[model samples]
Target: MPRLRYIEESEKTPQARAMIESAHKTGAPDPRVVSIMTRSEIGSAWVELWNKVLYEGVLPHKLKEMCRIQISVAHQCGYCSTVRSNVAKAEGLTEAMIEDLFRYETSPHFTPREKAALRYANLFKQGEQAIDKDEVYRDLAKHFTDEEIIELGQLCAQTDGVGKFVKSLNVISWEEACEINPKLTEARAEAAE
Candidate 1:
């Protein structure tokens, strides 16, 4: 059970209702969004900002989704890991790639550029200083333009902040959480042969 009650559509404020509807249009409504909706005042602003950050950015949305999933896994945030993984799939990432994400350094599926970004994400998850290291920035610069690096950094930070918040709250139970798509997992396994 969620630590916070999931807000019902009928009881939602107009703002919350709109957000919920938007999420529905995207397919299944995320339970985390519903949990956030319980706090109408904060949730409304958060939802708007979240949408902007995730959807409107210089970096490709697919890369951002991948970064989010990487951060989620590093943080041990089950909710974020599950949701972002699914979003990654919708954005065209292969299941084998996602399954091999943790092994990016050696995974044949990831390109050098992606490996750089994921490495940055891992350092970001480690804390501020890890990202601040000159070596990290140098490595990033080799693959990403300065602007792209900034975008990736911001995405990693935002994902870490939000993912930790949701994970800390214990809003959604393990059973209620979105599981990695079984079909994708099967595909990944078969492809490894």
Candidate 2:
């Protein structure tokens, strides 16, 4: 059960309702989070910004999806981890690729560009103080322009920060993720080790 109450259709503002409907149709963010967020105008705006960053921008949708899922898995937010972007799937992102996310460095499915983005997402998840900013940016520069890097960083920050909040909402916990896919826990554990 969600710790936050999902605003029902009747009570939702028109903007909120529209966002919830669109979120359901898109499938990138399950309607559950949108439903809860649309309760406030600020949250609704946040959802809008999320959509823009996720669905628009210079970065490939599939690449963003890859980074999103990787960060979600690292954070162990079951809700975020389980949600899939239909657009990304249609664009050729596959379960096979996702399965190799924890081992992206050695995965044959990703390109050098994709791997760089994944590496950026991984280090960003580790917290600001933990990263070697100059070295990370230098690596990213080889595969991405400054603008693309900014978008990638924004996506990682958004997922890492909000995913933690969502995990706390009881939408999906690490324990639940372990139940759903034991491999997810195992992969994270192996990564930690």
Candidate 3:
């Protein structure tokens, strides 16, 4: 059960309702949005920002989704990891790629650019001090343009903060949200053997 009441469809403000409907049309509505909807103003703003961050960006959406999953994994946020992993799959990331996320440095699925971005996300998750270092930006620039690096950095930062915030609330587990993808499940099982 969620830590707070989820606002019913009927009880949702028009803006919140529209956002929820949009998300539902895209497939599954994010459970965090539903839980946050109890506070319509905050929920509306949150939905809008989340949409912009995940969707409206110069970077390819697939890369953003991958970065999100990596940040969630680095944070050990089960809910965020599950949701973003599914999103990454939907964006055409293979199950093997998702399973190999922690092994990106040696994973055949990722490009040099992707490995750099993933490394940046992991470093960012370590703390502000880690990300603030000049060496990190220099290394990231070898594969990414300044604009691309900034966009990726923002995505990583947002995922880290939002993932932790939702985890702290304990509103929903990945299991409760039904966010697990069958492909990932199968890959995980295979990797275990």
TM-scores, all candidates, are 0.80, 0.94, 0.81
lDDT of 3 by residue, 1-193 (tens): 5566677756767776677666665432265544465366775676677777777778777777777776665555556656643454567877567678767788889988888887887788778998898899889889888888878877887788877876666665644433555444443333233
Which pairs of residues have clashing backbones in candidate 3? none
Summarize candidate 2's per-residue lDDT along 1-193 as a digit string, tens digits: 9999998878888788889889988897889999888887887888999999899999999999999998898877888988899999999999888889888899899999999998888888888975567888889999999899899988998899888888888777777877877778766774564
Question: In TM-score terms, which candidate is top?
Answer: 2
Total clashing pairs for each candidate:
0, 0, 0
Q: Where is model 3 more than 4 Å wrong at Cα?
A: 27-29, 35-38, 84-90, 174-193
Give lDDT tens digits, candidate 1, residues 1-193.
5566777656777777767767765432264555465467776677677776767777767677767777776665556656643454577887577777777788888778888988888788778988878999899989989988878877887789877777776755333443544433332333233
How far residue 53's Cα lies from its native spot in candidate 1, in Å, is: 1.6
- List the candidate 1 regions with Cα displacement exceeding 4 Å: 27-31, 85-87, 174-193
Show the lowest summed lDDT stretch of 10 residues, model 3. 184-193
Q: Estimate the lDDT of model 1.
A: 0.68
